[model samples]
Target: MSMFLITCSSSFAQKNELKELEKLVKRNNTTETAALLSTVEKMLPQATDDQKAAYYFFKTKNLINLANSGVDFNENRSKAIESINHLIKFENETKSKKYTTEVTALKNTLLAELVDEAIDSNRNKDYKKSSRLFEQAYNLNATDTVYLYYAASDAVNAKDFDYAESKFKDLIKLKYNGESQTYVATSQTTGKVESFGFDRKARDLAVKSGTHTKAETIFSKSAKPDIYNNLTHILLNKQNYSEAENYALTAYNLDKDNVNSLLNVLFLYYNTNRLDRFEEHAKKGIERFPQNEILLYNLAIINMQNNQNEQAKEYLSKILLLNKNHFDALKSLGNIELQKDADITNKINALPNTTTSNKKRNDLMQEKRLVYTTTLDYYKKAQAINPKDESLNELITQIQDFLKNN
Candidate 1:
């Protein structure tokens, strides 16, 4: 009899608390709603199924109100999600559509609010806050995995490596390639082509209404290679060379047509002292991007290291044709000329002390001076592009003295 009385009192208290919660939620009184929500959650297990349903529904509503009121935003947003999820499950189990629809609508509103705030924060350059908001948005709607991707990117920009690592791994697990098709049409009213951005139905409707023409679908490029490349960059920063190389290779394999991806892998290999792979990727990158200055420059350096000066010169000349003020290429050409002058001087010094040899030595000395003069011209051009280079100033002075003396 005592147990029954205790149950009845608890039930009466739950009813009164729920009524107060409903009134507070309707009034948008976030502070009292938050305090009462805690009281209601504790009484939930003892409440009837219908009472439990009411508790969850009101809980979700009150928490959303708290979130909008800016009182413990992150905590309220998370708790609101939990309440909504429980409400959905309970509605499903009872085979009723009582509160699920309203809860879903409320959740969508929260998701939109979070996403808009996240975009605004990102625009403000508050990357850490943006990342967290995007993550919360993703949690509210797991089907929208793009939010997770954005969260990871913002986390990387914020230098939150641990969060970025976890989110990137989640994306990889989900196989998020980020490829999609866009719809476009030419507007009949304006006589201009318009992009609908994945809204095919809207584009079709525009065409059907005789307000547009040329409805088309355009497939976007896959983003997997870029994702893996970012992961590789993070790992490289952490000095985890083996894992970095693995991810870089994954990026390379996924990037069949992306020159930037190829370049990233080439850099990774080059920095890791894997010269063979670096040369291999550099040549492959050149094949795809023949006019790419960086690829051409990298190949030139490789050839120079291999004692192939003429081939290196050919690459450097190509770079200059593509971009006239290529400072590094010009500087390299100057160094090659200096090397030729050194070789000529060595031969002249080794010549025998005789009349014919004396004449040969004089001729070689003139040739050396001519080569040295060419080097000076190259250095001067390079200096014109980068006048603040200290090394170039010293070399130019030394070359001027050498030309004057011999």
Candidate 2:
């Protein structure tokens, strides 16, 4: 009987405090409400569901007010969101609508505030703060993955790469394409075309009202490729080659028509010594961009490295056809012709000191002369392309001496 009386007395006192708190909350008395909320928290364990509901509602309102007043704004905003979520969960489980409608509007207000601040932060180039705000916005509206993307992009600008990577991974997991459709129409009043971004209903209504004409829907490019490319770039910076290759390939496959995407994959494969893949893509790139100097030069170099002299010459010849002043191609052709001298010299040295051997040696010597002449011609062309290269002069003098002495 004594314990029951003590419990009843405590409950009665808690009920009186709740009434005072509700009054302070209703009056918009922030300071007193905050002070009273602290007291109410301790009494919460003994409070009934209705009392708890009222406390959550009041707490959310107070925190939002404090946030607006710039009193630990981020913390207060987060706390307010937490409180509202709790109220929503309770309302959901009990099949009650009390506070739900009001809290939803409050959430939208909070969202708008966060978005405006985030834009301001971005405009001020406070990238880290902007990233945080965008992340908060995303937490409020998880359906808007663009906010998450903005968060990741700002984190990148701030060089907060770890956070950027995590957010980018979240986008990939969500399969966020980030493609938006725009409804466009020529405004009848202004005689100009206008774009209604991702608001087809508004565009349709305007068209129906005869304020616009020639309605068309267009889609922006998907951001998935860029996301994969960014992930690959970060991984490459960390020298995690295997994982970088995975993401690079993903980007390449997703946007096969994009030459930049193909180049990114080609670059990774080339750097990783995946020559076969590089060659394959280089050929494809050449087919796509027949006049692409980089692809043509890369193919030439690849063929040269593999000792496919004829194929290398073919590619180098094409490069010269596109750009006759191609110094590297001209020098490369000279070097290829020069390499024949060593083999011919070896065969001449292997001959016996006899009549037949001398005749054969003379024939080989003539062949060597033809090779040197051809090499000199190419070297001269290269020198003409780069007249400032004194090394080319030295090479030309050496070849002249050899031809005169022989």
Tens digit of per-residue lDDT, candidate 2, span 1-406: 9999988987888788878977887787889999988988888888777777777888999998888788998899888878877888898887767678988898899889889999999999999999999998888778889999999989999989889989999999999999998899999999999999889999999999999999999988999998888887777778788878888889989987776677777778877889888879887887888886666776777677778899889888999999998998888898888889999999998998888788899999999999989999999999988878887778889999999999
Clash list (residue pairs), candidate 2: none
lDDT of each: 0.86, 0.87
TM per model?
0.76, 0.67
Local accuracy of candidate 1 as per-residue lDDT tens digits, 26-132: 99987788798788889878998878888789878878787777888889888898888778888899876767778889888888889999999999999999999
Write down the worst ten-residue block by lDDT for model 1.
Answer: 255-264
Superposed Cα deviation of residue 40, candidate 1 (Å): 1.3
Candidate maximizing TM-score: 1
RMSD of each: 4.9, 8.0
Runs with alpha carbons beyond 4 Å of true place in candidate 1: 1-5, 78-86, 93-96, 124-128, 156-162, 192-199, 271-274, 299-314, 331-406
Residue 367, candidate 1: Cα error in Å is: 10
